[model samples]
Target: MHPPDKNPHDMRTAFRREFASPEVWITRTVVVGAAAVAGLVVVGFTWLAEQALGLFKGIASVGWWLPLLWTPLLCGAIVWTTRRFARGAGGSGIPQVMAALDPALSGGRRPLLVSLRLSLAKIGLTSAGLLGGLSLGREGPSVQIAAGVMLTARRWLPRGSGVSAHSLLVAGGAAGIAAAFNTPLAGVMFAIEELSRTPEQRNSGLIVSGIVLAGLIAVSVYGNGTHFGVIHPGPIGLALVGPGLLVTLVTGLAGGLFARLLLASLRGTSPDAPSRWRQRYPVRFAVGCGLAVAVIGAVTGGATYGSGNEATRALLDSNGHVPGGFALFKFIATWLTAWSGVPAGIFAPSLSIGAALGHDVAWLTNYPYAPAVIALGMVGFLAAATQAPLTAFIIVMEMVDGHGMVLSLMACAVIASTVSRVLSPPLYTALAMIQLPPRRTLPLATAGGDTDDSATRP
Candidate 1:
């Protein structure tokens, strides 16, 4: 109807509204910016951690007792700083992220759990732990840090936008895993299995986009390659199947036991008096744990220190001659680190321990294909520890470039997860439950300005 000429300004406004709505623009910009920042943070943190570990190794090579003296002080300072400044920054950090994702607990505590302050503290303290030769990994801490970055970035979005905080948290954490391991699929699987208790339709696109963007950034910086060196097994023979099954069983039981022990220590349910005592004196306990790690490093000639990345890579490179007690020592060191109540992750250390166990198994059985066995052990142990078989197997498969061992790795992961479930509850879930307070009902105002039972119901 040509009743009146349309205003050019109004037409321009309509065109702009149609093409660049605030909701779409803000959401897209935030997601892309957050993912890019998260990728950069992960890459930088990883590089720093590697440098710190290399420096520590260099120092250890200079003298054996140096770590024994250096680690206790480093651990003591880290624990003290963690307690004094960022209490939420301690531990593997995955549990804290899980806690912050809960709608009930997230309102006020999200800032405390995942913020710039906490991210900075986590990166510094965790790198310090590595420099001290503590049996820890940076991967879990990276997840927490990335979540912090994304959450902080989301605050920059326009108010009343459609972007969801919960979705951003999930996407950020998944991106962290992708960047840390350079495995986009593993990152998505980790988000589905470990982070998201209930997958939502709205968050799926955000999750995938974040992962892809972050993975692209990581691959651009670090190049497309396996985290652990590649292994090319010539054939999947019948002879290896029996030993692979045996490796699966042994690693499953061991990994399950490790998880149980960690849960016991965290919950103060350990029957061991030492564990209880350590829980009481956390700082002293951390120092003691550091000392123990130093001792293990000495005994193993530094094979049991740091994230175990170098050792795992060596094994994957077909150098199967690890020390006789490397697996045992690494396990003990990692257990002690977990019990210490410091900022550390068990992912890389756990994988290294698994690889060591595999090497030991191969040595004992005189198996020719040590790398294949090691890969299987990595999947099994990680699956058992996290109780996420798909995530575990995907991470190991991606790390080792073992696409050929997909069926075998999957089998080991399923078996180990089943055995681990029988041994204990999922590690991250149990720890997250500990962080959440008991739910309470809030009273709502009635029409008559009076409180009622119905109004108080959650």
Candidate 2:
């Protein structure tokens, strides 16, 4: 009893008992296989989105007025398809995954939000929005798409497979985020912050494996490069406080306003003529929203269309060189795109808007740390918009390879999130709650039930 037996046969027997169990093998195979599949699926979606954007850019290049015609028609068709066939494939897609994972919802409703059909529909419809020059992101929708793939894998597994649906959902969604942005760390944080309320569960291994596999697919193709390349902003002395505060305040207010608008507009409680029309005739309203986006794109010389990836790059390359009011145009375009009832996301667009804001502030103030300011803008806006500061901060810091600005980025994220919270309840949480049954009013921990999407078209 003083010392445990060092018998080799007993040690081997115990090891086999733990590692060679049937449930262990099944869980490993099923979860890992699903993660790899989800990785491939997310990579395919990224390629499709890029191709769609390329097509839109090519056609728009032919005529400056092309998106004006192309966007409206295609967006109208997209909204029609989303409503008629895959009603659950609407919105940012993160909220849908969250709703499916919510314990408050019944199991029967889970399939509505995360299923094979919904994943396929989400990829197609979101790509359609991109092809039509809508200022939407595929990254947000990737959460639902990957989660759908993982959940589908659950059905193929045998009984007592060791992994719970909740674990699979969290892992797949986190994997999706990692695959989409090549940010495995953000994926883990997002799973903890937005996807799961019960973080005490021992799914750490599951979550890490999913992120690694899904993220590996992206790294295999892109060669492990940072998503937005790298940035070096020299040094920041005492000058950062004023300019940093300006950037944080602007992004915070702007992000909060964006979330507030999306809530009111999507909830059908805006009390505006556009909101009324959207509630009454959704497809027609989508057409109109598309028209607005096209006008913004044309006015911005096509800068306001697409996911703003290239624009953000150019902004990073050139210190605050974007056209005047570029952030405002992009903010409006992104909001309209989200409000159009299409299966798209505002995640990337929010980052793009923040970059514009940072650049504009740099222009106004003539700050030397333009790149740092831009990075701050990205984290601030994203954190404020999603109300997930850690995820936002990590995403920006990793994407830009700006680890040197870790403290600054973290501070900005916290400040922006605080400011945003004052104006709007959590955007993703509020949206997820609306996915619950209208009559039940389940005891979900959401800030606002005032937002009822039932009034809007599915």
Candidate 3:
């Protein structure tokens, strides 16, 4: 029915011409280039965090009392630096990114949360936390830093372009997760689940392209290996069903309680004297937390330090056994570190705690599939803590290459997330709420210049 001049070949030619437009090409090129830069920056940040932790561990091994002396000093210095220079850079950094992505909450002050200076200070301070034996991770901070890089890079693009700052931030955050954990799919899922709640019809290609490009760059540098070494649980059978259900319940309860405690503390609901004092003097509170971490380290012989990567790796490898109290001590240490008002994250620590609990469960029950149990516990606890079941299970599954236990992992994540929701709101969302400005209403004035004083005026 078409005219003779508008043939199929002509239509194809027009399609190619539209696709080759400068604006389209420019936007695509900028997204890919920015993603690659984000990958490199995240890789570098991971390396720095590792080196800092290694150096601190080396120093701690030289003497038993060294941490007792150095931990307080490092804590004081980091707190002072954070307070004096980068007030907005403290904590896990996820909430700040969430706040930035929200327009009504950010109120044109998003840059204050994720500027170049804040990014640099986040790196330095989080590294310092690790060096001081704080039970924290670099992964969350990496998200903010990557977003900063991407946002900063967007300024180089032509003005009034199709690219949006929010899209860049979501892409950068997803890229950071990919680079940090080497889990590209999980990164994409996190972008959809946590960062961007928008429909896929809007900017999905740009977001996905950025994540893919960043993941490819990271793979080129770090090789295509899962974050955790491979664990083969053989074929799944009916026997694993019971143990898996038990792990779901246990981790769900534990993770839900942990989330509740954290939320209560952050909301100033803790009636304890120490909690009150900590709120009064945050600097002194930081030093006290550092000392407490040192004490835990000394008591555990350095078992409760850093991000618990070595412990988790050991458990995953099935070569070592953590002490019965390791998980409890680590939980307390991590909670205190978070309360210290410092720049740190709970990602790695939460995984380690979950792994330790799994090991304990396996030991007590004599479960034949310890690795499977551990993996389920990890997914479950993470799901409860973040209240993002899909993101939680996907990240854990990718890290361990546990495709064989997909159904079990999914079940555990769902149970844990449901339990956690009953106990508390999602952690990142609650924290983001804390950063938002409180709404206020101004009094209306009458035509005679007198303010309306009706108590129940609408």
lDDT of each: 0.82, 0.85, 0.79
Off by over 4 Å in 3: 1-18, 199-202, 269-271, 441-458
Model 3 lDDT per residue over 1-458, tens place: 85666444677777775586676677677878888988888888888899999999998989979999888778867876776677678778887778778766443567767767777888889998888888898878888888888888677766755567888888888888888877788788888889995534555787798887777777788888877889866558887777778878888888888888776765543678866765566578779888998999899889889998888887888777666699899989888787777788888888898888777777777887789888888888888888889988998998898998899899999998998888888888877655554444422111100111231133
**Per-residue lDDT tens digits of candidate 2, residues 164-211?**
788888888998999999887888888877887765345568667777
Q: Report the Cα lDDT for candidate 1.
A: 0.82
Whose TM-score is greatest here?
Answer: 2
- Judged by lDDT, which candidate is best? 2
What clash count goes with each model? 0, 0, 0
Q: Give the Cα-based TM-score of candidate 1 against the true structure.
A: 0.90
How do the predictions measure up, each by TM-score?
A: 0.90, 0.93, 0.91
lDDT of 3 at 405: 89
The Cα error of candidate 2 at residue 315, in Å, is 0.8
Ranking by lDDT: 2, 1, 3
Tens digits of per-residue lDDT for model 1, 297-362? 898888888998888888777744567777788889988887777788899988988887787787
- Model 3 residue pairs with clashes: none
How well does candidate 3 match the true structure, expressed as C-alpha RMSD? 6.5
